[model samples]
Target: MKKRSIIGLTMGGLMLIAALCTKAVTPTLRLSDTRPKIILGTAIPTKFGDWQEDASQVAAVVNPTTVAELNKIYAETLSRTYVNRQGNRIMLSIAYGTDQRDNLSVHFPEGCYGGQGFAVGQTSQVVLPTVAGGIATSRTVATLNSRVEPITYWVVVGDKAVPNSWEVKKVKLAYALQGMIPDATLMRVSSIGEDIEQGYQLQQSFIDQLLQSMPPDLRGHFSGTSH
Candidate 1:
């Protein structure tokens, strides 16, 4: 009986040591101080290339209810209306979250548009060829009554442009494993026009020109790459 007790005590002590060692080696999934915080307003250029901000038309793109929901999720949101010399207009909306956990992830455009009574159609993932490289993004045409808006957007998870929910989770997990909480930003650009193709072309042009016009360091906030 005494020998059995000694063996049991040795096993218990070994288990306690193993538990303490694991507690030390295992990384806690916590926010790392090394990650940089991105400020949306300052990071994005107001007047870039041929596009200039139209302050008065800001309210025409997004409704109140959607804005209210956005306020809840995003740490900072920027909504701007830009028009070029050719009279083409693009609405730019960027939402950033410091903590991109499952509960605080971005509210993607399809759901937001659906909530606003817009029918989402022609949804597909596209690789946008930028100066940095090919960045993955999603495009969709949303319709409501007489209005048709084509949107081209991407979500940056950590420093990568994630195309869909799966990629978002993958990237987030990658960061979490490194003991860091990742930040995310949803960069969206849309134009109102009946021709979805033309709208997309214009939105792409706007994005390209905007990226080119921005300072080198600031471009990564939109493009999700250092280049």
Candidate 2:
């Protein structure tokens, strides 16, 4: 029999916990503030454990762009990509803020769930404390036995800027969604090959969404590709 693998994701080093035990902090959104806590479109090295640098590095690039463009990219990518170790192969980001509720519900469903468990206590690298004063975050990681693979996630609550280029941004967003798959299911070549295809789709969608959502001033900056 093929080795059954536990899909796992380590989000910046944070762990998933039971929703009931978890606190829901109301996110504060301000239309006026568009500036990012960190410089937009800059490379952010991996701060978490051994898990690959694909997602975090990706976000560091695109989070600063407009939301409209980002969403466009997101929807497109998911259609093209497949969930796997490489990254999320989807393209949907609109549900991010709201999906926190959805994922929490999945994680702590009314009945018994196999991936219900979370990583043992939090690790320092897992948590990315708030910056810019307005941002707050809630994250979780889930493992899928045969269905989806395991993944780590970061649900940021705020009108804060995302880091990285468009490609990286898509990776981060996809990871947030597909991170639930088990690790072992992803090791297979078939799974990984599909993931790469999906990764590009996710990246394209992220780019489209960020471009669509960008404010006039920011959009100009992105078009020029200088800084």
Candidate 3:
């Protein structure tokens, strides 16, 4: 009976020590209260350069399952179609998550498009030069039947633009270690056309002009730079 009692005491003491160590290592952190000050709809201008919002058509380009998933993950989402004077139309989608953790990260267009029955093809990394600095972006061409859509998209994790999943995880872990729950946004611009090169060029031009027209303070939020 004494031996059994000593074993029980030793196990309890070890469990207590483990619990104390966990408490010491785990960060005592919470998301900042003043985050996500810039609203997506108001920050992005309605009319920039020759591009204007197309009010006639309402195409979100997201499937029902993805939409449902997004509703749970993101705090806000904006989907709009913009047309230029030369009849070039681009679909713009932005999703913002207040808490960008592993389970609640922003969804990329490549996977989302694949989920929506679109065949994703030929993905490449591209650098888009904004007024602040050069932001790394991903370009992918998605095809569905006769429609070919060229997409340019990027994800902003914390204050930096991450190009791939590996970078995203690194950024998130860095923030986590600093006791911060970083916010993230996924910005995507796509156009349906035959020439993928021209489509990407136009999208870049659109992004440049749009960034130029935005407020100086708010530009960093989208461009992932303080400058």
| Superposition-based RMSD of candidate 3 using all C-alpha atoms, in angstroms | 3.9
lDDT of candidates 1 onward, in order: 0.82, 0.26, 0.81
Off by over 4 Å in 2: 1-141, 160-227
List the candidates' TM-scores in order.
0.83, 0.22, 0.85
> Mind giving the per-residue lDDT tens digits that candidate 1 earns over 1-227?
99999999999999999998655544454342455566777777778888998888898676424556667777888889999999889999888877787787887888889888999986799999877667899999889999999999899877889777788988887777676777788888999999989998899888998888877766776788752
Q: What is the lDDT of residue 56 in candidate 2?
A: 29
Top candidate by lDDT: 1
lDDT of 2: 0.26
Best by TM-score: 3
Q: Candidate 1 vs. truth: CA RMSD?
A: 5.2
Per-residue lDDT over 43-124 for candidate 3, one digit per residue giving the tens place of the 0 to 100 score: 8888989999997754645532466887888878888889998898888888888787678888888888888889999778
Judge candidate 1 at residue 27 and give its lDDT.
40
In order of TM-score, best first, we have 3, 1, 2
TM-score, predicted candidate 2 vs. hidden true structure = 0.22
Off by over 4 Å in 1: 1-36, 63-68
